[model samples]
Target: QYNCEKRQEVKHISARIINGNEALPKHWPWVVAIYDSNDTLVCGGALIHEEYVITAAHCFVNQDAHEFSVLLGTTLRTNSSQCNNTPKDCNIQKKTTRKTEVPSKEDEEYHKASETQVICVGVESICTPIQNTCCLFMKDIAVVKLKTKVNYTDYIQPIGLPKNCEDPPASSTSYSVGWGRIFEYYD
Candidate 1:
């Protein structure tokens, strides 16, 4: 069974930060990196269930399901090599310990003795919300089905969802974390 309540606390001071700081290992365990057929990082998603991920519909607007894959259990955005050449060739391995690569000297201090068990899986299908054609951003969410069910671990888990269709308190604060372009024309 999957546990959705298994999440680490996230602290945010302001509504937005110019460039966010690096998160701690396993801090956002449900986060996954979405890659294109060329194994290039396209977007970031969250594991909502054992076999499902929630990402933006715009990320796959005209893309095929076979052209995408999800990488789980790593903090490095450039960890596509861990997925091997293709998603089909990637297999779920037993818990194995391996040192996570730290790209820069600054990141080394944040990831001392860090380890990660990366899993790469192909997308079986994508489910998008039905909406009018007038607006492109309307109902821009998508649910992606994974080719294989993920085995949960300390570094891999599902995120919790709201039980009722109720709005959050007016005083509530929310935070979003992902790897993406800093500005519209940056990347």
Candidate 2:
């Protein structure tokens, strides 16, 4: 028997994250920490499918697909304590990037230049940004492909995507999360 209907619900009320807080284990299982080749935490992403992760396109700027890694099953971005209990290894199999044509000459030129400079996941297919418009200034979304099929666990899982084009009710709650320093500006 499955307990999906009566599980403890952990959710967010808005899309903005104010001061960082400790997330509980198995609470936000889809959340992941994106890292560069140097093992530096560069951004945050959510697992939306067994082989797909959604994150910001800006996160891959000046970065190569081979130089990226993702960490799951943990709350602290820089620590591996959560995965120590398990012996199985988790690996990222692939990454995908969708190119969108921006509106400004300056912005468009910059994006084109950057695309030439950095090689993102292979261009097997192209799609627009998650927003209704493909403007980079406002729409900064990307979907990354993982090479291996994800094995769901107590700390790692996939999130559900919207089924229709309609917007959510204004009363609905949304949550946004990321990995970063506690203070954005320090004197």
Winning model by TM-score: 1
Model 1 ranges with Cα > 4 A deviation:
1-3, 9-15, 84-115, 181-187
TM-score of 2: 0.62
Who wins the lDDT comparison? Answer: 1
Clashing pairs in 2: 93-147, 94-145, 94-146, 94-147
Misplaced by over 4 Å in model 2 are 1-16, 79-135, 183-185
* Per-model TM against the reference: 0.77, 0.62
Show the colliding residue pairs in model 1.
none
Q: Per-residue CA lDDT of candidate 2, range 40-143, in tens?
A: 55788887776678888877755566566566655544422223333123323332233222325434443333222211121111123655555675768778
lDDT of 1 by residue, 18-124 (tens): 45555655677899988877766788999988999999898898778877878887767654556433446333222233433344675575444344467788898
